[model samples]
Target: MDLTVLSYVIYLFISIVLTVWVARTLSRAGRVFLAQVFPGSEHLAEAVNHLLVVGFYLVNLGFVSLYLKSGATTETARQVFEGLSVKEGVVLLVLGGMHLGNVFVLNKLRSNSRRDFAVIPPIPPTGFLPEVEA
Candidate 1:
């Protein structure tokens, strides 16, 4: 097999495996945070989590497939490793960025939800009403 073809295969395999692992990890752990963000709606949280995983797969896999092409010829072993490293590195960075974006948005939602449900003290009624004349 051509080294370039080998590199493409390796890159696709690693990218897909990493994406699925990260998505599953996030879905499992994020449920609690989502539940808190959408208090009294565990079902909604679960639904949102499932949707998120599906979207994640669609997006990351699309990116992986689109990014599969190597810019330079890969005739040598060193070139194959270099290509794989660069490709995988970019994939990792993209994954990290997506994770951070998700967390940032969810944290904002959680904060807003907390603020909406915050308790405020009521003010005491002010001084005396006028007496009525007989």
Candidate 2:
């Protein structure tokens, strides 16, 4: 096989493995976060977790497949390494951005939920207190 083919194989393998690992890690750690956001709803959290993971896989895998091609010909081993490094770096950066976006949205939901949880209005008294007898 050509060096370029070898590099492609290695890049695909590494990119996919990294994507799966990151997705699993986020899904596991995000349980507590989802639970908090949807307080008292374990099933909802689990369902949301599944959906998030599926979406993560779709987006990342699509990105990986789309970004798999290297315009530069891989003639040498050093070139392979450089190509792999650039692709992997971009993948990692995109993954991090996705993670941050999820957290930001979830945090916003949690904040809204907390704010809307009040049972009573916080209005002050409209009338003054009557004077007490001496």
User: What C-alpha lDDT do the candidate models reach, one value each?
Assistant: 0.89, 0.89
RMSD in angstroms between candidate 1 and the native structure over all alpha carbons:
3.7
Candidate 1: tens digits of C-alpha lDDT, residues 1-134: 99999999999999999999999888887787789889999899899889888988898899999999878999999999998999999999999988887778777878888888897889898998999999
Model 2 C-alpha lDDT per residue in residues 37-97, reported as the tens digit of each score: 7888999999998998999999999999999888999999999999999999999999998
TM values, all candidates = 0.88, 0.87
User: Local error of candidate 1 at 25, Å?
Assistant: 1.4
Quality of model 2 by C-alpha lDDT: 0.89
Which residue pairs clash within candidate 1?
none
Candidate 2 Cα errors over 4 Å, as ranges: 119-125, 128-134
The lDDT, on a scale of 0 to 1, for candidate 1 is 0.89
Give candidate 1 regions above 4 Å deviation. 127-134
